[model samples]
Target: MNINKKTQTNDEGPEDSNVHGFTSESVVVSNRVPERSTKVASYLDCSVYARACGIETMRQWFDYHRVKEGGKPRPPGIPGDPSHQYREVWKGWPQFLGTNNVASAHLSDTAMSLTDAKAWFIKNEIQTVKQFRVLCTEGLRPPTIPACPEKFYNVKYSELLAPKSGRYLGFHEARNFVHSFEFNDYLEFRAYKRNNPEMFEKIPSSPDRVYMKSSPPEWTSWPDFLGYNRITRTRLEE
Candidate 1:
């Protein structure tokens, strides 16, 4: 059956009420079929199946769990970027949606794998499962949810696009972003710059700080957003 169609289905999950008005049968997921319906897991087994659901889908999860007795405000166990404050990520697995070990071990001790989680939710009547799975699995599409509730304002504009946008991963909207690092990434950035020397003349941003070489802010933005803070691009080829 075409999951994208907005047709009604008798089979739905208990979580359907948490779907925020959308129905699972009407949602469209990725072309890839779910892994296996029987693959089981527990809520704590999240590292393997937590998917980067869309902003709207995340909102639905938040709403669904908030009112439930001993509910969760966010999906548990998925590793979200600290910089982005867990609002969004590159991608996530959905099998761990409501896995709250602390809440109840009976339901959390064993559940479905991320692959089966989508189908399970759909079967259980979670209307947003199909759409949520698509947004997270496809990785390049915008959400179809219209007119979100105002309570969802906590998710930022950048957070909404971060999962789907390569641009957001690299720099802020302004492009000229200054980041200070002291770890392996800092070493990698410096090394990358030394390897591919740009012909573009670079001015020193901070004479005292050797790593703080400066150039046109707009130009710096181009390389930075591309994950090349150390390398600069120019119209002229060296």
Candidate 2:
């Protein structure tokens, strides 16, 4: 068991001697926990380490890390228990809140917070999921932003950043909405969007690619959605 020598000393008050054998210096100072180098030993459910480090209960450690680390790059170790796995380090935090629950306080990579990243999307006019992906594939996205922001942030793309790659009206809803436009065919629908980009800001520019991949249940065919079937039937009758 490697002990942090930095936390070994400190002669202060009565609370100092209350902890099993560790000192206040070994635990927390000014509401700040130790750095990643600090080890939480796996014994008695890490009671010794937890108490020494100002943690009242085992479950409190989750809240501790959430507040301190923004729940990114998990702790170097988790206290051993029946339900929890014991490891020196976790690669990342699991999906929970699916929101920017904490400020980007401990993130070392980019200074941009979740809010900042979202703003960048709007500023760049990245309206659809496909467009965002193409930018990432072409190496046009900034290094400060992740190509898969959902994984990095432990939240779905639409939840963290809306539209994923484009507007996602539910499959049936999208089909109905597109049909209401009275487009003669898929090509005509595409041309309409291209010509009147501002009018369709909330709608995806490429429904065929975007909706087909996303909407598994209600997605039938582009021809059905874009009124191409109706056009084909009319042409055949004529």
Candidate 3:
């Protein structure tokens, strides 16, 4: 582990004849020949010995000298290479979408919305929107989102929807916007109605337009009211 930082002088002209133990100095000379080492070293001095001894030796050497320290712990084994255990644990972990399943599909959609937001922000020079999109989506673009442009508002929604834009809106953004509109509860209640119109017609609407009391009536127990059972009946009727 005897590593030396070699320094070269301008006048040295790339070659030196003066040599010492594991060290050399260069001097400017027109006919200097490259030095070759012919002496054999012990097993302890070989690179194979170093690798066989493992990266612990390197870590200890680094830690003792306070060189390039303080980051996430490097995986064990060769300093730059991952250990077998590291590979086994992260074998299927998705790098782009976090998971390799249905949730990844949803996240991919969220990424598209963020990409649009980013494009709009860059085009308008809206710093806040740009920052928000960056924070929400992380740095990398998701598969469903378009490639981010240098400037925003340069592209139109029509362009985005076009085949050339190669991007699409995701369900997560749609759900978020709908929730922001304060229509989530209504949408949830009417979800079944959308699938079965006849059964939806059978379930009676609230007698009072607004339930202002401290405790609202339990619609599930009311026979004519729309509830889980009514929704199920609609599905069955279908």
Candidate 4:
């Protein structure tokens, strides 16, 4: 059954027309295939003809006739699949349309690996997933970069993209460095931290909070951690 190339302004329906089982009425007719069928016709009115052609959607039926008449198949990502703009048509044909699977298996296989992606992010100064997504939205992301790497790679993107510094020191090592200062209390420790911003970058800002459980056995409290003799100080003050 070939869809007619011309429009039908006459009152004659599909039965009277030379067109096998299709008409331009209520259906978009393209040189190849129409984009989609009109919702004006109820499903019952369109389903029989659609089923007879072995096509599920109105667009499929039109494509079948169009091809039968020697029109080529529409290009990929155009009229073949429902896009974000086709949500209205998608609702009516839930079984055949509106699939949300955007991640392409081919792209996933060919795109940059997670290790390379992290290095690229660091080089480009992209430290957050939100920034990466914004770049993807703006079409600034490279073809090698996966749009949703966490979804594609099954790992947390934030942790993978975290900025790594060579100067970073572990809790115990940083505490050892702080103990060399012999600070009297938290105030003195804060004063030193304020003065030496570069040193604090290597150390945790709040050791009390960061190393609560992980601190070494010598870690009794903030005073002890800072090498402050609180007992001796209290005795001297009294």
Instruction: Give the runs in model 1 whose Cα sits over 4 Å from its true position.
Output: 1-56, 68-217, 220-238
Q: Count the backbone clashes (under 3 Å) in each candidate.
A: 14, 5, 3, 0
> Which candidate, 1 or 4, has the higher TM-score?
4
What TM-score quantifies how close candidate 4 is to the native fold? 0.33
TM-score for predicted model 3 compared with the true structure:
0.16
**1-238 per-residue lDDT for model 2 (tens digits):** 3334343355554355445455544444333333555565444323434555454422444545564556423334543331234322322221111123232443436636666676676567676677776675465776567545655576555543333543456666766677777776777887888898777665677665555343132456666776555544442211
Clash pairs detected, candidate 2: 76-88, 128-165, 128-166, 129-165, 129-166
Rank ordering of all candidates by TM-score, starting from the highest = 4, 2, 1, 3
lDDT of 1 by residue, 111-139 (tens): 33332442333333323424444443444
In terms of lDDT, model 4 sits at 0.51
Tens digit of per-residue lDDT, candidate 4, span 33-52: 32344433333323323432
Which residue segments of model 4 deviate by more than 4 Å? 1-103, 164-238
Q: Candidate 1 clash total?
A: 14
Task: Assess candidate 2 and give its lDDT.
Answer: 0.51
Which residue runs does candidate 2 get wrong by more than 4 Å?
A: 1-4, 7-62, 65-177, 180-187, 206-216, 230-238
